[model samples]
Target: MIQPQQQSFNQKIEVSNNFGIEVYVKREDVLHNEISGNKFRKLKYNLLEAQKLGFVKLLTFGGAYSNHIAAVAAAGKEFGFETIGVIRGDELVDKYLENPTLKKASENGMQFEFVTRTQYRDKNNATFLNQLEEKFGDFYLIPEGGTNDLAVKGCKEILTDNDKMFDFICCAVGTGGTISGIINSSYEHQKVLGFPALKGDFLFQDIQKYAENGQWNLVTDYHFGGYAKINDELKQFMKQFFKKYLITLDPVYTSKLFFGVINLISKGYFKPNSKILIIHTGGLQGLQSNIAEI
Candidate 1:
């Protein structure tokens, strides 16, 4: 359920003076809700799994600006579940945060529990969850970014209507769920490409394990500066991209992959006349605070 804006099928190639190759964007930023993007699909199967497991409470993790957290919180309120968001770090000055993602999560009636970065890493541990079950009672846990089988299943639904096959399908890889899901459902004629937003060191293995040997291509380059970091060049390109196409690309995830798509295309990567489909994982709500200006 990518927001209406993110799911929009408006498709075309926009040639920008800044980018050497012709780029066609899927217009996911406009898919649905202002907050739509990758978050909805990631949560879809997860919610179903929660229901199947007979779980009443859902606990997950994210940074203050995390799209997954916001999506889960909103989904919880809408679908009848107790949602707990383990926000990384203390709240500090909430007003200083430019991204309204966290605020929206609260409005969605999601409960929050802030933890140190160190503790957050071990949140999936038996001890942590045992304590949680003791206090909250029957609950299911979803990994950060909603990385799991349900996410892949939901993403598979993205392929039903589109008939075109692609030389390579690319997406901004955060936790490897979106790309892996696409690869799993991709027809033989298509190959999946992933741009790691963080270090790709163990990501290939992660995707393979998660997806169970689906057709995939790992194109590592466009992680401007790790997961949450942005740079001036990325901002310049984001602005230029929108100016040429009148489509918005927030500075966080999709923008990074959009940049990588161009970089790979120009460097003798994609075959000529090859159809390259990019999965815009949606996170516009998380982009309100990031730099996207030249």
Candidate 2:
């Protein structure tokens, strides 16, 4: 099993503007090299629990260029557990030639098993697990997006004991597990904010089901087009922001929502002098993979 490493606490909060919002960022971006960002926080306990449960092999689901798959493969190699990736679509045999994420996963020694788009759609169905067993034998299967109770447990630990209480906290919502964990970890006085990247079909309702107390808000306009989709404005903002602040934001998850937070603050939507904390879920490896296209 892969052992978890010590987390580093870096950077500090400062007043960058006169908007009265005390914006602070938790640098989850620098968690590790290959095992970077939110993936580490989400995967830490899952790996540990899998090991504790006597699981020798780890199985998880992801797409052709999934950050979760990349992290799982690297973590499995680092922890000595055999890793298998149940990839979406039956194009694995033809994808490695051009798919950067899959290429990196192979370099990390992860075995790939392809499933049809139809089969991958029903991840919770018994037939999927049966097919996995028939192909690669028994293994601990992690849900796609890494949103599990164990993942929530690990993410809640992101907030250390020394953090000052804030009136509100904000983060991007992908699988809703991290948001659920943040809501669980925060005090009653504080409110949790979720900016959703996936839209349509009552997304916040699902997130609310995971979070206790049902006190969360979604900044729905920031998703741009969809998951991993970006435009000129987002790319320009990312470049300029990095140039000015030396902090990087990936187009898929963190950057767009953070942009929304700042936009709202600038528009005077948030009350003056509000203390806000933004969680930086990391995906630079995936960003790097898209350098040419970006």
Candidate 3:
């Protein structure tokens, strides 16, 4: 909530007339430096609730290059709360300094506890959470992808009345929270499309939990391989995209989402003169780790 008054605007992307589609990007990345894009939306109310409950510390889970981890750390530093990140992959315990994201989080005063992948999977296990509470004393828990009722509530504000002009509302889905909020806030005529970064059948059920209506659909063909997986095609696309639009897309999420939307347009998925609005949920900080590839 550093710049709570900031509002994101939609900038139109130049699409070919042959495709019969109009693409616009919601520049949520400019909302803040650390808590950029959907991270700020997801954490807004959670942070307020934590403070209301008299908690001075916040705990969350993520991987080595997680945007959520970095954002949580930055929020903790800026908002005056102690922060802890339970990082996946215990091997990173000794080499975290080599990672830009982890190093930045550490600099922001986030304490880290590296756990193996198996242990990290138990993040929601009652006994595991109890153990963390026992060790950390007391802290407000934010989930791995920062998805929850409050998070969906905050995300609901991503769209405004002006956004209703678009026929399709699109965004990159992480844990389904952002899309759920969009689904709820969307006009009944608008089709909420989510391009997921991960591959799984569970996401449908996960999204169904918070979504109030059935106006949304997931486009799963564009994950590249899976979460955090990238190839030369994606890297080249990112480079060419930046060269053309001057918009830097994160390898993990936004890049794939944009790619999918463009591909769909080329395939005649959208009708003539369809206005598609895509959300830019920033994860650009992750470029530091994958810079060599791009």
Q: Whole-model Cα lDDT per candidate?
A: 0.71, 0.78, 0.90
Model 3 C-alpha lDDT per residue in residues 33-113, reported as the tens digit of each score = 888799999999999999999999999999988899999999999999999999999999999999999999999999999
Best-matching candidate per lDDT: 3
* lDDT against true structure, model 1: 0.71
List the candidate numbers ranked by lDDT, top first: 3, 2, 1
Residue 213 in candidate 2, Cα distance off native in Å: 3.3
Model 2 compared with the native: what TM-score? 0.92
Candidate 2 residue lDDT tens string, 3-120: 3454655454553667667877888877777776778888989988888888888888988878888898999888878999888889667767488888888899899888889987
Per-candidate clashes, comma-separated: 16, 1, 0
Candidate 3 regions with alpha-carbon error over 4 angstroms:
1-5, 291-294
Q: What is the lDDT of residue 189 in candidate 2?
A: 70
Model 1 residue 28 CA deviation in Å = 4.0
Q: What is the C-alpha lDDT profile of model 1 across 85-173, one tens digit per residue?
A: 87877643355134477777777887777777887787779897787678767778888878888887776755544635456677878
TM-score of each: 0.87, 0.92, 0.96
Residue pairs clashing in model 3 are none
